[model samples]
Target: MTSLTIPSPGGRLASTVVAMAVRQRAVIGDEVTYVVLDRQWQVVEPVEAYLEYLRQEQYSLNTVRLYAQGLASWWSMLEDGGLDWSRVKVDDLARFKRRLRDRGIDSTVITLRPEQTAASSTVDVGLSSVLGFYRYHAIVTGVPAARQFYEHVMGGTMEARSRYASFLGHLGGGQDRRVIGRRREPKGPPPFLTPQQMKVIKDDAGRLERGTGWCGDLRLRLFWTLLEETGLRLAEALLLRHRDWQPGTGTTAFVEVQPLEDGRRRLRAKNQQHRRVYISDELDDLYGEYLFLLVELGVDVQDDLPVFVNLYRGEFGRPLRPETIYDWIEGFKRRHPLLPSRWTPHWFRHTHATALLLAGVPEHVVQRRLGHRDIHTLMTTYAHVTEDAAMRAAADWKALVARWGATA
Candidate 1:
């Protein structure tokens, strides 16, 4: 990766004028952790402390990366305004939100639409991260300003009642405190690919030719099929091992989604939860074909080895990096103008869940299949679809009432 060096402006806070950056480090036992760095490349003690707290609390690496970025942005804002972090107030946070809306961290980023500002979702995430940092400090170090950022209320109070509901309803009618609220983003339907688009991409990846077997990269074909059929995350699919797949002749096969200690990279399934995802017979056959091709290429068929490896690249037996898959997707986007411009592998997952729900599958079953920790998450994510279903039911009721009135 190319590094950009910015000349520090002449100021008392020059040591952090370039703001702060998150740096990754390997701790004891080879576990990777992140820390924030100042312009002088020194570790920011307070930020590191917060990140270490998250690590101890078993937050995933992805979560840590996000929190680290938010803290870094906060640090940069402080540096620009020559304000002390300990003295941050609600007003300062509000100003920071405007700054994010106007220019973001780096305005130099290329975009076709220049009028568009930072997305509300992105701003909300950053705000949440920053607030989380202060909340941590307030509880652990008793920072006065940070403590003042929150106010406690009795559970019976309207404020407390409004804040706690749904899954958190149990906490209502008890002593509760409210933190700073994030910007509310507009809800929309989950983005998914159409069946035709799915077929086009799958064919583009690996198409079987007449008189010949599979013509293109059979491994990628299998990988695409696995993602399309199983709704596995890119990381989960890339981290899959040969033993995870259980194939049977003319019967349904299953793949186990479990965390494993991978030396190539430390990618894990979301929440590191273990679940079995069943695959179609065609997908199982695809897996078998890929395995056969691997053996033909003299690749060892070790059960513990990763199912996807860098076959064409010089690093023959190394596990495929997540970047490799992303690069391939970018290539597909370039070649297929008809495909969604912002298409991603995760689209397959959304499509999978949407298809299931539209087919009259139970919400709880879809929740389990998607490995959602709670039904609420699945419901909230696909609320648009559920709401439409409800409207359809109401329409049916209206039609029945009309028929009864005519009969009467």
Candidate 2:
């Protein structure tokens, strides 16, 4: 039996190799072999320490797989330097951070495209995951100095965390060092159709009615109408079921959204709150036509059946994905070729809110309709739309003063 001594927080300690076996078991005939060690100067084989961490933490299988791969890569980097656990130091960890930057691993963007380098956020997250593995090993093995090394090397403190984050920012051409507190720039306003332009779009969508049967045309018509009238999120509109509709007079009606896979009825809403929207008269008519069309298609007008179905048959026929609405909007853009590139489905929600605010609806009411939890959200996001109203009020006040002076 060969004995290996590693430095621990307590002091230098000796471990003996007990047995050798491969870390992973082969699915088919045989498993890989690797040596395992015991605490005494005797060799003993034990299960991989990282797997124990996953089991103890109750990590999901996917998470375990990711962590295992990341740890393996980190261990390989350490081995390339001929450094074992006891030999690892803060400077070594710093070098690893640089290597990650060199490899272009980014955490911010889910998928990287050509010419897209890893963003600072992305690198930090990946490094953090790798750091977690070392931290876990230190705790489990009862290595005395291991914990201190990890803290100085990878602890989530302002200084330790900043070293890696700053390196990432430098890589990305920025000066930001703090990782968690940084705020992303606010997205520009949602592009919306003006009242006149919406009339044009609706009319264009209506034109599709002539070629397609009434049943097919109803889907596009109602989809557009709901977007224009309700300010519902695209997913919310697509997830609507028959039971969600209420046809009573002067009463509020709404569609309930359930979680769906893909963009089609996917549960990825802004805040995960179930929104109940009042159907506008125009939307009600569209919904009526949709119901009639559903009956004609021999599709039961029951709650279980998807309210919206794919016009073309394929896997997509499950229900309309949010992208489908955007695709249609894109098609509309192509047909017109005159609309601005910024125009999108979200623009309809913004347009709806802006129009209501311009018509003297209360800011709070607009907030509720838009599912904004705070009134400030409406005021801040749509401040530009209210500027004209403010200007008109100022002009009206001046006119009233002039009239009073003349009368006196």
- How would you encode candidate 2's per-residue C-alpha lDDT over 299-355 as one tens digit per residue? 655676567777554454366666666777787788898877767777778777766
Q: What is the lDDT of residue 81 in candidate 2?
A: 60
Q: Pick the candidate with the highest TM-score.
A: 1
Q: What local distance difference test score does each model get?
A: 0.70, 0.55
Clashes of each: 0, 22
In model 1, residue pairs whose N, Cα or C atoms come closer than 3 Å (at least 3 residues apart or on different chains), thus clashing, are none
TM-scores for all candidates?
0.78, 0.54
